[model samples]
Target: MLRNVATVIWDGVAPFEFGVVCEAFGLDRSDDGVPLLEFGICAPQPGLVRTSLGFGIEVVDGLGRLEEADLVCVPAMRRGDPLPDGVTEALWRAHDRGARLLTVCSGAFALGEAGLLDGRECTTHWKYTDQLSARFPEAKVVPEVLYVDSGQIITSAGTAAGLDACLHIWRQEYGAAVASAVARRMVVPPQRDGGQAQFISRPVPEIDAETLGPLLAWISAHLHEELDVDSLARQVLMSPRTFARRFRAETGATPYAWITAQRVRRAEEMLERTERPVEWIAGEVGFGNAAALRHHFTRVRGLSPQAYRRRFACGESAESA
Candidate 1:
């Protein structure tokens, strides 16, 4: 049902974040059977708007365009730049008329300024989540996820997460077949759950001789083994308690969580590249059985193993195939 879309910009807009909305909604995908949206870019005044990267974009539509939009988008803007006059009022009008509002990165700040985020769960780029929370005490800021869709408002984390959110909307509005088609054209995964971590485990050092780096690499390669805290502790010559504490400190996740996440990632590769059965893959990835694999894969990737394989196997689209 989302047919009309508009993005409002201000001085000092981030080009990449703005482009996310344009690519998702502004592009004509009618040739692929995706519905064409009436998309437009608007500003407080119709003219050239300065970008954060020292470039400018000519926006020909004014705030009035948002009146007819089914969805209104706001992209990242410089932190300290003043919100254009009437921006908040325009947002309020759009919301009052039942149009969904979406924000990418620091664009949530504009919604915060408009008081639209009050009593709503929202998110922004991880770098600004704390500031968004501090500035808007009533807004529930979920910092660790890729995006948050709270009914009438949607807020996404930094950069590429915006595309994830847009795909989610497409899937909701047009079904998975249509969404997958759009994603195929964009050359991205058809679906990435919003619950997925905004920041996954940081890359471990490849050649560290004096840290847990070597053990971490070994764990990845030996994912088929029954990895437990005590065994891992023994491998690193540390007590279980000490190893657990240090692993959490270094990886920002518990040993169990980290290992489980890695196993899911490995399973994803197997699903994408091989025609392996789910039970076999589960055992190879240390899940022991297909049930456990399905549970964790669904929780982490928001899809069943079979569904993931269907969508991604052999690097071909399930629909097309």
Candidate 2:
């Protein structure tokens, strides 16, 4: 249960993300008779902090305030800049004293820089996924999900996703009912399971009106079929090389990658809607075997097929038995 929370601020901090954290924890919510959170903004200098959006905020506390906090939050920062030396040291001290560390959006960069996320599952805004993964390979970077809660450390995706993460923390500490009440007071959805996808770039395929649309429709309807690029090319009356080039140009992904993504999408739908055996679901998704299905599903979804099914399958038996 978190009663005391502190947010660390620096120059160039995003105003909107910072405000989200403040609204979640800093506001006096005792009017509704809910347990009020002790929240305040802390800076290294204890003065006006300039925001990314050309405004200055007067903060009263400094990094020393974090020592008494049960939870510490760092909001988004400008991409590709070194965090201030004092802020880094303060974060390290707070973590050493057993504060639950949290980062929203590019704040993960700060955590990653401090090496707090090493070997932990985490995520940030999808736009920074590649750079974050490259910078912190030791940290398992899960790009698609809204947030990752790895016990003492948590990281969330872009802007609005931070709201979901904060609500989740409230739920875990005070139970869903209290969290729901807080959400109603705040006028937002009470619970958005952290496993929900973040903003993903979707590039639709382009084919000549004569051939492409129908071919994609066929592939989607018959995912159980073996969809080799050579065979698909033959269906569209083009050579494999030409077909592969066209597919990549249109969809911004290779044929194999696109097919694997679609198969995983189908598997996700089935796992949510049915209680099929993992092996059977793998076969139906054209993965040939459960192992291959698990491989690709984990690659895209960050969870094994069995785990995904368990999370979503609603307790029904396979084939409605």
Candidate 3:
């Protein structure tokens, strides 16, 4: 459904952030049965654009191109620089016309300038989250996740997180199979939420091994087993209270939260890779029964297990749904 994507660039744009946007949408992957996206770069002045990294990229497209885009992405810009004439107004028009909007890192400031973020749940780079909050007092700025998708308007954290945000849109619009294929092409995880409960079932892209790492691996290996705060605390050689505190401190989540996420993640994999019945998958993932699994899966993913499998399952047999 999101066929046309236009990325807006301007003076002082961060190159890496811009490239993340380009890599996410600008590449051709239809060879893998993914839709070929119509991606382009647009600039307000329609010529050479200066980057924060001391280089210039020649952009041939202008804001006029943005008018027809299904989605408009803005990359990180000079934190406090002036927006070019008509840039902010164009963003407003895009939003007014129902175009999807996405921002990476300090690109959020551009949305803030257009008054799009006010009263909407959004996020930016952790370093700039406070500043974004201070600048746009009405916007709900969530500082701790890989990205935030408040429906049509999506915002991501710093750097590679932009990839996650883009893939999220892709998964929603097309399906998980398409998103996964694109991710494999990019060599990045299709989804990662950094242990926040809201982004349930999505794994963190990667983690460096430590005391918490071994615990996480153990939990993943035994998701169907009863895993409670007290039981896990004993494994870690600490009191339940201390274990909860330490888990949150190290992983940004509580013991119960992590285990629940792990179970949901297992459900997702089974739903995608196997044709097992919902009741069977639910019990295997430790949700105990279909009713309980539906409650948590719907609460977290906004879709039921059957619907998720129908939409995301991998092969021709998956079409049976």
Candidate 4:
């Protein structure tokens, strides 16, 4: 149903993230049976735009091209640049015409500035969560998720999370089959729930190289087991306090939080790939029971596992037939 898409670009754009949007939507993957997305890249001025990394990108279209698009995408911006004056007006016009608006990373700042996110649930990169909340108190900013889709407006976290949001749009517009095929061609996961926490720095003590790698691997493999800091510390021949310190330094997260995230990731994979009962899957993923899994899954993914499974896996049976 997405017949045409326009990506808005500006000076000091993050090239790789900008390219991710183009790669996902601009290319024709019809040979692989994927629906073609009519894509156009536009800038405020129809000329060369300087990237944050000191490179020039030649964009041929200007903001006028966005007038007829079914969707408008805004890529991440450099840290502190002011948005163009007319750009927000152009976006407001597009929204008034009923076009969907999307943003990747700091691109949400533009949406916030345009007054589109007021009284809506939205998200941006965790690094800017506080700033976004402070700047737009009327907008509900969810910092932990990979992305947020509030009907007509969609926003995502940093870099790779942009890919997830794009694929989500594909799934919503077409279906999971098409989104999965596109994801396969790109060699990325088709869906990652947006609510996963951004990995942040912790304050663990340093461990010697000889024992660290094996210990970490062992913990990952035994996630289904009862893993307390004390037991893990014993395996690495360190006190609980010392192990906690080292984990923070090495992984940029506490051991407990990291373990929970890994378990949730596994649960998501099962929800997409298998038709097991939620209660059983919860126990298998080390949540101990279904209620605990539902709590954490909702907290981390912004949806119950059942709701996510229904969205992505519902049509599988029909397709298989």
Candidate 5:
């Protein structure tokens, strides 16, 4: 039922985030049995808008285009950028008319400025989650997830997560088959688990846990082995209790959790790049069997191993391209 997508842009807009919105709704995929939408780019000023990377693009449409769109998307904006009052009024008017609103990255800040994020469950990029929470006390900021779809308003994390959020919308409106088709063209996973936490840099490297970094790297390399806190602790020459404490303090997750997360990440790479069978991938990534791999993969990615392979595997598409 969703159609007529509009992307709003402003000065200091991030180009890649804007492109994510465009890729989701702007494509002419009618030949592939996908719906074609009336996608347009709009800005309040209706002229040149500068990108965060010091580039400029001409905006041919003005705010009037948003009046006709069934969905409005806002891309990431530069931190501390001034959001014009007209943009907020346009957003409110679109939402009042039952248009779905979505924001990517720091663009949530613009929604926060518009008062739309008030008392709503939302998220921005992980690095900026604290700032967003501090700026809007009424809004619930979920930092760990890739995106949040609170029905009418969808907010995503950083750059690549915007693609995830957009694929989620495609899956919701057009079904998995259609979403998979679009994602195949885009060369990204058709759907990713929104609840899956982003793999942060040393996700939690404080608390003098820097020594655990090398151990994590080792586990990432040898995911095929059966691993446990006790064994891992032995490698670091610490007691199991002390190692568990240090692991949680450093990575914000247990040994099992961190290992499963990394295994899932490895499986994803193989799923996308190789034509290998699920059973083989399971063993290769330490899941031991297809069923276990499927369980953990689904828990982390919101889709089955076979389903992910079908949707993302570079099979016929990669060779033909």
Candidate 6:
């Protein structure tokens, strides 16, 4: 049902964030069975809109174009800039008429200015979450997750998290098959677990393939085996403590957390690619049993294994599952 999309831009809008919306919905992909969207770029006026960088983009339409949109997108913009006339009012009218509102990174500040985020749980880039909350004390800000979906308003973290949110909307509206196909075209993961906390700035020691990179590839190949810190340490000729430190420094995740996330990714592929039973997938992915797989899969994906397969499996594989 999310066919029409209107992306509102203004002076100081980040070009990369604005491009995220255009890449996700503006391009034509009907040959891949993905629905084509009626997408447009709008500004406060129909003219050149200056970007945060040193350039400008000519916009063809004005805010009036948002009137009939099914989805309205606001990409990252400078937090201190004043909202143009009718910007918040137009957004309120769009939301009131049941159009979903989405923001990328600091763009959530506009919604805060509009009072739409008051009493609603929302978030922005981690660097700005504290500022977002401090500025709009009534809004509940969750800083850890990649994105937060509080009903009609979806706010994503910095940079590529916007793609994740867009794919999420695609999965919800069509199915996982379409979302995965679109992700394939974009050359990014179909879905990713774990929160953006892993991406926060950290001082990592200098590392190379001689360190944990090859070990990671090995772990992916042997996921069904028991992969504990002690066992992994022996493989790399280091003690458990040294290996654990090196692993976290190189990958930004503990061995257990990274391994479990990979196992879940493998399980997801198997569930979609083969009509295999959940118990078999559980064993193959190191979960050992259907009950364990169901617990972890549900916890990570927000849906049960059976439900995920039902939502994502393709063609005859889908019907059989």
Clash count for each candidate, listed in order shown:
0, 0, 0, 7, 0, 0
Error of 6 at 312 (Å): 2.4
* Tens-digit lDDT string for candidate 5 (48-83): 999999999899999989999988999999868778
Q: Give candidate 4's TM-score.
A: 0.68
Q: Arrange candidates, best lDDT first.
A: 1, 6, 5, 3, 4, 2
TM-score-based ranking, best first?
3, 6, 4, 1, 5, 2
How does each model score on TM-score? 0.68, 0.63, 0.86, 0.68, 0.66, 0.83
After TM-score superposition, the amount by which residue 259's alpha carbon in candidate 1 deviates from its true location, in angstroms, is 14
Q: By summed lDDT, which 10 consecutive residues of candidate 6 come out lowest?
A: 193-202
lDDT of each: 0.86, 0.80, 0.83, 0.82, 0.84, 0.84
Candidate 4 — worst ten consecutive residues by lDDT sum? 312-321
What's the distance in Å from true for residue 183, model 2?
1.1
Per-residue CA lDDT of model 6 for 1-321, tens digit only, reads 889999999999999999999999999989998889899999988799999996999999999999989999999999987899989999999999999999998999999999999999888988899999999999999885678788799988878888888887887676666777789889997865425342633344455536577889899999988778998999999999988877777765678878888887788777767888899899999989999889988876778888878767764555323
The sequence of per-residue lDDT tens digits that candidate 2 reaches over residues 25-141 is 887777765679888789888899999998999999988899989999999988677877687788888888888988899999999988888999999998898899999889899
The best candidate by lDDT is 1
Could you tell me which 10 consecutive residues in candidate 5 have the lowest summed lDDT? 312-321
- TM-score (C-alpha, index-matched) for candidate 6: 0.83
What residue pairs are clashing in model 2?
Answer: none
lDDT of 5: 0.84
Candidate 1 regions with alpha-carbon error over 4 angstroms: 204-321
Pick the TM-score winner.
Answer: 3
Q: For candidate 4, lDDT tens digit of each residue in 1-321?
A: 688999999998888879878988999899987878789999999899998898999999989989979999999886466778689899999999999988999999888888899999999988899999999899999876788989899999888889989988886766556777899999997766555445534333335344366877777677678888999899888899988877766655678887897787677667766788888888888898889999998886667888878765644752110
Model 3 error, position 12 (Å): 0.9
- Clash number for candidate 4: 7
Residue 232 of model 6 has an lDDT of 91
Better of 5 and 6 by TM-score: 6
Error of 6 at 36 (Å): 3.0
